[model samples]
Target: MLAEERLAVILETVQQKRSVKVSELCNLLNASVSTVRRDISTLAEMGKLTKVHGGAIALSENFAAVEKDMEEKAHLFLKEKQAVAQYAASLLEDGDFVFLDAGTTTENMIGFLPKKDICFVTNGLFHAKKLAQRGFRVYIPGGEIKCSTEAIVGAECACTVARYHFTKSFLGTNGVSVSAGFSTHDVNEAQIKSAAIENSIQAFLLTDHSKFDQITSVTFAQLSQAQIITDRLPDAKYRSFTTVKEVL
Candidate 1:
């Protein structure tokens, strides 16, 4: 295979297994040990992997080193998130079936929820408990736990979410633009969010003002698929793509 093909295979294997020794990659890729080492070194320099003493680990596994964690994100744009989430929670009424996405902004919605009968299906590991505590019947998907985002992701999450139909869906995003639509840092988590949108009667994407114009690793849905809920609309260009609910 070509050099590019070999490099892609090596990266995919490491990401799938989380870590891979040089000797295992050499056998799997059918390449020389020296070539595999060189590829690992190149990927490490590019921040795709972390080269250890004898192997390499996927960079995504060390998410905190690259991006802020849940606690850190909780303090950012606190008022804006609360305002937007409060409005989102207000949309909930008795017997409404909904989705509460996994993110700091969506997490804020739990606090602002009114005393109403609602059933929630969520991939947010922490969100399930909070919603249940508020007397909302909550269901979580069976899936792999993504510690970085405090979410349950992968195919199992998508399958579980697909089985239910929602009246309304509240989602979170890392980036929004007219061209790229809604994006997030992880593909697995993105799949779950996309599935939620697909199965909802009305889809609402919630994000802070800061996420505007910023694109992340994966685009989960088209801008036309959901209405945008945020603190402020930074750019007029997005108006052509989707409706924006500017809380401020």
Candidate 2:
């Protein structure tokens, strides 16, 4: 195929899959490794995609401006996120108070949680309403709600979360790094996440493979602060400080 045609195909595949590995793209396009890499580099430079070590992901998946349209991310990495959520839900006991973060991965945990006798606190308005509708005791923190992520965060939300000590808290972040720790795009949300971690006896960081190294604007907590639960072990750079428990 021509270079333009190959690039178009690559873009379409990345948009459809949300992420595309170099080898997979090469195989699909019947192109050389060099050709695939060059195409990915060119697309990334044009701000069409974000290139990672093994693959390239659509830039739209990470942009906050488009987060409200969660349909774009709902089907991406579904199995991996569900596995991570199930593992996270298993950590809770019958009477334990839990805090759930706002993210696609964390949202999966709601379906896995038991329907009765649990107190759940969240800055995620969607989670709060879902749990409440299911007859579980749910508390929605008071604060400014960001419609994009359906998260309520601000000083008020932080204060409310601080008042209630949780048995466990499951958080999601935009990025996880040994040096930068857990980071998110919104400062207010980061503050609420930090508060949740501090108020919980045990904290778990839940993320999928996509969140490995990409940094965001604000740092919430360090790798040392919580046990990391993900779809797979992170890169070699994070093996030391992060206690990774891979969810099958």
- Candidate RMSDs in Å, in order, are 8.4, 10.8
Query: What would the per-residue lDDT of candidate 1 be over residues 1-248, giving only the tens digit for each residue?
Result: 88889889989987787667899988888889889899989888888887764667666433111456788888999999999999998888888899889889999999988888888998898999988888888998899998888989999889999889999999998877553578787889888989999999999999887887565667799899999988999877778888888988
How big is the RMSD of model 2?
10.8
Candidate 2 residues 32-121, lDDT tens each? Answer: 999999999999898888876667777644422112234566688899999999988877778888988887788899898865578989
Residue-level lDDT for 118 in candidate 2: 83
**What stretches of model 1 exceed 4 Å from their correct place?**
1-66
Each model's C-alpha lDDT? 0.84, 0.82
Give candidate 1's whole-model lDDT: 0.84
Task: Output the number of the TM-score-best candidate.
Answer: 1
Measured against the true structure, the TM-scores of the candidates, in listed sequence, are 0.73, 0.71
